[model samples]
Target: MSERREGALDEATIEARLKAELPAWRYEDGWIRRTYKTAGWKSTLMVINTVGHLAEAAWHHPDLTASYAWVEVRLMNHAAKGITDKDFALAAKIEEVVGWQPGAEGGPLEGTPTDPRFAYVKYDR
Candidate 1:
C-alpha cells in the first residue's frame, strides 16, 4: 500500500518514505543504496542474478557492484534527473526482493569486485 502526504517531497521525505515503505533500503546523499553480503564469489553471482529479476520487475534499475561477498546497490531516476517519488517507489519494490536498510551497517564483504565499486552488475537470469 502507498501512503500519501502533503507538500512537495524532497530528499528527506523521499528517503523517509523509502525507509518506511521499502523497509529495507537506506537513504543516502541523493539516492537509495542497498548492500548484500554473500558467502563467496559464486553466491555473489547468484545475488546478481536475483537483483536482475528485482530490477526488471520494478522497471527501475540501480547502480550495482559485486565482487566476492558484497553487492552494493544504488537507486535513482535518471530520466527525472533527481530523487523523486517514482525513484523511492521503485526502490521499495526492489527492497522486497533484496533486503536493505538505512543507517544499518553492511558488516563488510569478503572480497572486492574486479572493477570499480560503481560498476554495474549485469544478470541474464
Candidate 2:
C-alpha cells in the first residue's frame, strides 16, 4: 500500500490551485504537468539543466520528458504517492524560473534576442 502525505491535496484542491497559481500547468493522472516549448535542441537542453538544478536545490525531483523542441515536466510526490504541497511548491518555482522574461520587463539584463537566429526559448505570447 502506498503512503499518502499528510498534506496531500484532493482533486478539487489540486484543480483549484493549478488554476489559480499555475495557469500553464494541469493536473491529470496523478500528476501536475507543464510543457515548455523551446526553439530547438540547445534550448531544450538548457531547460532540462535548469530544471535539474532547481530540483536538486529544492530536493524535490520531477519527471521530465524532452524532445528536440520541447520539454514536459511532471511533478508528484512519489513517497507520498499523491500530490502534496511539496509538488506544488516545486512546480511554482520551476514555472517562475523557466518562464522569466527580462527583456519584456525592461530590466537591465536583456533576455535572449528576439531574432530567430539567436532565439532560445519560445515564450508564451
Candidate 3:
C-alpha cells in the first residue's frame, strides 16, 4: 500500500479481484463507483470526511460527493486504462470503514461482500 509497490496483481488478476472485492462498485466510463446512504446529511458529511482521510492515506484518491443523505465514490487509476489492484484494495477498505449493515440503507457484507448498514453506492450521473 506504500509507494504503489509493483501491484500484487496483474491486469487480468486485478479485474477478477475487482468483481469480488468491489461487488458494490460498478465500472462506468472506466471508473469504479459505489454509493452510500446515511441517516441524514450530517452522517453523509461524516462519511465524506472519513473517505477523504482514507484516500489521502492510501494515496489512491476518489471523486466523492456528499448530498443531503448520500455519499458516492468514483475511483479510477488514470495511469491504468481500466480497473486495477489499487482500486479493488481501496474499495475493499472503504466498504469496511463505512460499516454498512443490513436493512440499514448502507452497503453490507453478504455472500458477495459489503459492510454493515446495508446501503450501497451509485453514480449521480
- RMSD per candidate (Å) reads 10.3, 2.2, 8.3
Which is better, 2 or 3, measured by lDDT? Answer: 2
C-alpha positional error of residue 5 in candidate 1 after TM-score superposition, expressed in Å? 17
TM-score of each: 0.61, 0.93, 0.65
lDDT score, candidate 3: 0.68
For model 2, where is the 10-residue window of minimal lDDT?
A: 1-10
Candidate 3 regions with alpha-carbon error over 4 angstroms: 1-15, 100-125
Judge candidate 1 against the unseen true structure and give its global Cα lDDT, from 0 to 1.
0.62
State the lDDT of candidate 3 residue by residue for 33-94, as single tens digits: 88887766666887898898998999999988778888889987766645667877788888
Model 1: per-residue lDDT, tens digit, 28-102? Answer: 765677776665677677677777787787677878887887788787667665666666666656554444322
lDDT of each: 0.62, 0.90, 0.68
The alpha-carbon deviation from the true structure for residue 83 of candidate 1, after best TM-score superposition, in angstroms, is 2.3
TM-score of 3: 0.65
